[model samples]
Target: MLPRIFVVVLDGLTAMHPSPRIDRLYLAGTLVATSLLTACAVGPDFTRPTPPTATRYSPESRPDHAAPTMAGDAPSQTLRIGDRISAQWWEQFRSPDLDRLVRRSFQANPTIDAAVASLRQARYNTTAQEGFFFPTIQASYAPSRTKLSGNTGGNSPGIQGNGSVISTVSNTPASQGGTAPFNEAVIYNWHSATLTVGYVPDVFGANRRLVESLQAQSEFQGYQLEAAYLTLASNVVAAAIQEASTRDQIRTVQALIDSSERALKVLREQFRLGYAMRIDVAAQELALAQAQQSLPPLEKQLEQTRDLIRVLAGTTPDQDLNEHFTMASLTLPAELPLSLPSELVSQRPDILSAEAQLHAASAQVGVAIAARIPQFSINSTLGGNASEFSQMFWPSGKLFSLTGNVAQTLFDGGTLKARQRAAEEGLNQAQAMYRSTVLTAFQNVADTLHAIHADAHTHAAAERAVTAARVSFELTEQQYRLGYVSYLTLLTAEQNYQQARLSLIQAQASRLGDSVALFQALGGGWWNRGREQRAEAAPK
Candidate 1:
């Protein structure tokens, strides 16, 4: 059993011996018994707030409320309107480097690690709050040697009675230049040890209210972790896709430059043979220079994008990841995940985290309101003291005391009220922020959807342009061979065809990038059971 001590000190108050009031407080009939009885807590409970009714910016013209179903074995053979994105969505691209980079980011990203640490800290705080519900114990010990002068104040019974007086000094001697009395000296030694235990019982549940706030904060931290995970994955995927697009553009431009240089070479030979005018040769040379100029900028962009992918994949600044990262091998997805407006509320981690913040603010408001109530505390002590250490446990020397204190703030200049008002305003601010986040998420999804649709048409048009330019160039070549048209005419057709090809590649890349953006807007396929299981199996 734990030891307890309760010492109540009332300043400048004297006690009369064996009084009825003292007897009622110490040896009381029922007050002492009731004080030791168990107690329960009382406070407001927690309930989740209701979310907004409509999940979309606008209403759907037609409704299909049934859950999505799968039919065919292969995804491409049966593309449905509501098929969820695969957990390993990037795997569909068939890029091994992308797969490895995403997994490394999940394990080694500093931002994700910071979020995880914050969650663990919140969990520890919750554990600490839980410890308050149990009892507490403490032990103390003090030993000292003392000397007393027999003829000093110790000799006066009225001022030095055993139960009536408490003194800080051990004794005073009357021997040195004594005014009225003889002197004598005595010495004594004493030792003592004590143990104490106490608990607040959470009788009014103020402690529980504080703990509830902490738990809500912990849940908020969990939402932070989820949001961080999504952000890291999205960044890595976007960078990789952008790099792939850059690589494609670089190849397209290089081909155009080669064709332009060949035309310029042929035109120079014609000028030397006196068959082509100087003006025509000059035009070919200018075209070649323009095409050559475009290559360096595109190559630089491709290099920068590749380096960005390397950084997102958790590589050092000086590390060369270009050898391990190649864009030519990636396969672009033909389609993206279909998302319903209603699912956005739960699917987007950042929005969910904002909602959690709102909930925490609401709880803090309750805590602020609870602060206006009265406070109560109980303390106690049980021990014995005697002149002889061996007799300290005797019935006559046994001692115990119980104390209860209650306080209420009568006047604080309305500080508490101002704090309550501040908390209420904070809750309102959080609500507005949550609503804003929801709207932003909706807008993001709508924009991505529009781009993907538009880029598809653009890509098709560019493909047609390339085909027509190629046909035109082939016919012009035949004309040049038959001496019906000049070589300059043939070069013009070839140049148009080359430009068309580069434009087609750019359109293709844009379409693929917009597809990835759409999936990211809908919170598609970053974290799921498959990735979680894979991470668990990985070496720590």
Candidate 2:
């Protein structure tokens, strides 16, 4: 019987043990493999949202297909400044001042700094999430001395007399493996040291999914930073253009003032010669005063625009931008590039960010669903122990153990199911938001295009009106001097002429501003220098 028992024990040492926990892990792994490779994901996977049905603005019309062309003749579709706008669109204005200011803004703007910080934060987060893929190992040591009760056999051995021993009690002594009676206390001393290693692999790929989700988030932020950069570029360019427009208007008004003063002098001479009424001179004087009043406001506006650019460029507003950079004249591009709405989606960083967010939401659904599956952890502890401190490393004193645990939330009262549903809802919401953003972007581009075109026409008509008014004013002054017109009539013509000139100046500025708005709406000119910087700084 003893030989058979020994043989059985030896056989057990060579045989494998069946573990239900390991079987479950294998089964879950199989499920994950099949799902990732073959099964369609349950939640929405991101697809780029479509833009508008019409590529161009509804009210805006292209030039006639058969318009005559010449080598030096400009295209009607093109802006006056150039044929195609570069990624650094502001440079097309050919202003060194603008280039320098934009560069300074890119470097010093607080918003840009914040965006860079956020990008760094996302990189750190990615690194932290990656650590989950690796295992953890640790070491520990413990030493202890234990004192047994005095009734045990450590101090004094039990004594028995041949006749005094109870008959019921066995006379034989207890062996090492058997229960025994002893008279003295027993004591024990031991030391333990261990190195433990453990890991819970991504058996269901839940951890991998989580990392994917984080990567998507990181990408989303990257796109957001791009969007911010684009916005900042647009702001600086627009501000510079605005400042130029205001200064030009101030100059135009001053010219108007000079013309009005000349007319006023003629009116005063006529009044002194009894050919014009005192009221005529007084009215002309008032017109001149009003024109003079206009200059201060335009000058104020110009200064304000300069200050805005300075702030955006991360410089003191008191700094002289004009001294460092000349305002580039507002020159229209010769031909505006019309991008198909479908392609426009790729151009806007905000839209790309939205798409990335949708992807993250999709991955989150997988993460939530994975929680319902079993988790497997492999654990081991190798240790040394000894009865005496000095002999702690002896073979007989060494001890070790290996352990494994598989945990699954068998029942969670529908909590996991709800989480998955929430993730699905989130994905749907993101998709909806992405679609909405695209539609809105299309609307902006279209509206801005129409406005720019319409303003151009308006400004042209205003120019003609101002010219006609000036001619009428000159003729009326002659008539008044020759006593062919009344003072009141001259006053009426003078007022009309001044108002028309003022209107022309305002219309010019408005048209220039519309050009800026159109470029902003198109999200143009943000890629070149910004892309260069990105390339230079990108991680190796």
**In lDDT terms, which candidate is top?**
2
lDDT (Cα, tens digit) per residue for candidate 1, span 1-540? 111222222110113124344544353333334334324333334454455566444356432222222212211211234466665566666777878888888887788888999999998998898887665656566666766555454542221213433222333346565554444455554445554455554545656666777887897898788777767776777777667666766776777777777778888898899988999888878888888888888888877876776677677667766434334566657555666667777777767777777777776776677677666555545555554576454554445555666567888999988988898899889889988988898888777756655666677778789889999999999999999987767877887987887787677667656656766776765446576678779999
Off by over 4 Å in 2: 1-56, 59-85, 139-194, 254-296, 322-328, 383-399, 469-501, 525-540
Instruction: Give all TM-scores, in the order shown.
Output: 0.77, 0.71
lDDT tens digits, residues 92-116, model 2?
Answer: 5566777787778889999998888
Q: Itemize residue pairs with steric clashes in candidate 1.
A: 5-380, 5-381, 6-380, 6-381
Model 1 residue 267 CA deviation in Å: 3.3
- RMSD (CA, angstroms), candidate 1: 7.0
Supply the TM-score for candidate 1.
0.77
C-alpha lDDT values of all predictions: 0.65, 0.65
Per-model root-mean-square deviation over C-alphas: 7.0, 9.9
Candidate 2 Cα deviation (angstroms), residue 23: 16
